[model samples]
Target chain A: MRISDKYRYLGIKLTPQRLAILSYLDGNRSHPSAEDIYRSVRKEFPTMSVSTVYNTLDVLKEKGDVQELTIDPRKKRYGPVNTPHNHLMCNKCRHIVDINKEFKFTLPSSMTEGFELTGNHVEFFGFCSNCRKKQ
Target chain B: MRISDKYRYLGIKLTPQRLAILSYLDGNRSHPSAEDIYRSVRKEFPTMSVSTVYNTLDVLKEKGDVQELTIDPRKKRYGPVNTPHNHLMCNKCRHIVDINKEFKFTLPSSMTEGFELTGNHVEFFGFCSNCRKKQ
Candidate 1:
């Protein structure tokens, strides 16, 4: 079977397990963790170990096919590279949501200290309605 | 001598070591790590330990006098709460700089999933001119 175009650029051997992981990450905005992905993919590959999922993720991360997020502070989450975006998080519950729109910003050269510009990620912190009611 | 007004709101005992730390962090935009603080504070109080710096940082962080940053991935950095600001980083060298200006953004209510907005931090990634030259 041919590898899905989602992971075509990785240029690595596409094991059945790696293909499953890549399929899971395609268009995934929930930013699930390694364990989260393993738990879901394990349904199909019952014998698959979490390490397999981690190794696949590590390879994808190194290959720039995936982006890692630690917006939750205590846990790692993964999102698809299909769109460059930022994140919004609930300070109380630590729930994270994606913000697909890019903000236009430029730092004065004096402030950047001669760094050539590339890209930016904005993390917005807030209280979810449920958490806000708890206060 | 009286403690500087910078730490007056923390309301903790003004030990000489804690004072030195607060003084070190006061108006400090370098986003130094615990070891960085320890290294600099050691110059004056050779008896001071790294843990002392860590504990003091914990208290200040708990009290909201400092904000922790993990931009470097391998290490943690810190900045004072004196002013709300964002950061610009060198993707090549991982050098970080402060951008004191705030970027205004509004997420559609539908996008937030009912989060009450509070604050945002933008992390700009780039290659410092020196690193670009080296490449």
Candidate 2:
């Protein structure tokens, strides 16, 4: 979908700052942090603040248009893909890539006996190709 | 298991400090942070540092005797139970409780398409009883 349409679909007020963010995130595969997004967006809007970047990201996340990843411990990463998917994280260089494969595993009845299951996320951690080359 | 026996079984050398930590985590379910552990242990050992608490927790985690949780954003929480389980986090009060239930859900093949799935975790977010009462 077009960036303009995404903003309209999310019912978000289309400000210049927000449009820049949406444009940057559209089809962006590299999971970027709020700081990373702020620095990149500031290239055009030199006066953009980190807080604004975070606020915009939070708004986008709440709208279910973007996903926040906790794969990294230092800072939260944001992904443009809103679909259910898994992540591949390189432990050496902290690089994150999307795995487009489907997983099939039934949780044994012994694992979820009482509480209601809301959601599930699968994460694969290992050395990526670049990091493997370094070693 | 007894604290002394746990250390011996894990092949970990037991020091007075280490024993204190083990005793504290033997069956702990509160999901305490490093700071919380350090503070609690400090009542007995006045000089216990935060770094020691973190180091001990890291070693314990590596040995598979404790599990570290990313449910909290500010700090990592550790659980004493090594069994597979899910967590219930109260968004309002930040309280974490364990749900000793088994979950049964086959991940649709569309969810894990290209990558090897090594592990999975289920996290449920909601207001706990106390937090619900507050609202």
Candidate 3:
């Protein structure tokens, strides 16, 4: 596969496996876990080990090319760094859907204490349609 | 210390170690990790082990007596389950401050995708005064 010019801009070494990982992540909204990436990419590069996926992800994370999310407690998930958005997650199944709108709100200074305030994210937790049906 | 009457309401057998863990978590907003609880509680119960803390936390989680938070990804943090609230965390220190106000939000159907939304929590990420000083 041809390496994208964007990978060049990231200033990381682009091995075949790294290129493959980056290609997989590009525009991937599934918010795949590392294991998910490893399982899918290994179909092409049979020699690809899980470690390679993690190492490439670490490099990309350092370059600010991707975001690592702890939205799911049992495992970490990755998504493209994009316009500021929040997530809605299934409390039972951990399914995630991106909410693209931005929220505008202010916190009481009493609650914030003396911390220098910054950006905020909202996480909506509930049963997804499928999980709700199972209930 | 007296075993508080609240523990009985949960209907779990409370061993001394379990009680110690419960006492540590009671009204505690520090969001202590299992390891943090083990280290502190062991100072009192010489035989208290880390696994015991984890097991007690698991039981408490099952009983819905305490909340398990993934706010700090490296380990699970515990917090009191009280009135609806949110958190502000320092990105550098991973310190959390409770935001005790509820946000009223409604999601557009296109964004929700048939999710049976239950609740939402807002997380504000920023540099705390201590971390800002170091920066």
Candidate 4:
């Protein structure tokens, strides 16, 4: 997918700062947090503030061009994958990998008894290969 | 469920503080954060600190008596429900309700390609009645 086109389609101004952030997130599967993004992009834009990174992520999330992951308690992570998917997190190393599989199970009638289900995200947690190797 | 027995079986010390926290979580559907728990418990034990609440929660989580919810971006919420379940959160008010229904979906092979499946949590987001009314 063309990152540039996605930003334009979302009506976001293609500023150098935003473009830099977008380029970093393009095809990024590591699910980096705001700090990670800031540190990485700051290397290119030395004067970029952490708040700007957060702002860009917020805008991207609002535009549905990215997903904010709350699976980790310490920090908020972001994923550039815009499709319906699930996550597998390594409990030991804190690495997050995407699980591209689809599950056909419907929400139990009892669970959805009252509220209307709008969207769902399924998350799986376990140790990754690297973490397992360390053990 | 008997809070007393639950604690005893879990081998956790039945301190007055722990009991107070457990009572607060019992039958609680409005998922509360650590700060919420500290505030509520502090009404009786004014000396209680936030760290204590977090420590108790960490212990409870390890024993599988409580579940830590990461669906909210601002803070971590806790649930007393021990069974497998899903959550429905209000996007506007941030109210979280329990969905007790069971879904019989198996993960698609492609999604689980190589990683071992351990556990899953499904989260649903939308506006609750109060927020809907306001809108």
Error of 2 at A29 (Å): 3.2
- Lowest-lDDT window of 10 residues in candidate 4 chain B? B126-135
Give the CAPRI class of candidate 3. Answer: acceptable
Docking quality level of the chain pair in candidate 4: acceptable
Error of 1 at B31 (Å): 2.4
Q: Candidates' lDDT values, in order?
A: 0.71, 0.62, 0.73, 0.69
- lDDT head-to-head 2 vs 3, winner: 3
Residue A56 in model 2: shift from native, Å? 1.7
Best by lDDT: 3
State how far residue B23 of model 2 sits from its true place (Å).
3.3
lDDT at residue A128 of model 3 (Cα atoms): 82
DockQ of the two-chain complex in candidate 4: 0.34
Pairs with steric clashes in candidate 3:
none
DockQ metric for all predictions: 0.40, 0.17, 0.43, 0.34
Model 3 agreement with the true structure over A1-135: per-residue lDDT tens digits: 233565665454678887788788888877789999999999999999999888888766544455666677778777665535488877556677888888878877777778776667788866688766643
C-alpha TM-scores of all predictions = 0.64, 0.64, 0.65, 0.71
Candidate 4 TM-score for chain A = 0.64
Model 3, B19-84: lDDT tens per residue? 788778888877788888989999999987788888888766544455667677677887655535
TM-score of chain B of 3: 0.64
Give the CA lDDT, 0 to 100, for residue B71 in model 3.
76
lDDT of model number 4: 0.69
Question: Residue-wise lDDT of candidate 2 within A19-128, one digit each (tens)?
Answer: 78878987886778888899999999999999999888766654445666655667787777444445655544546666665444434445433322323445554445
lDDT of 2 by residue, B15-124 (tens): 77776887787678677788888998999999988888888876655444556656675677766644444655544444656566644444444643333332344555
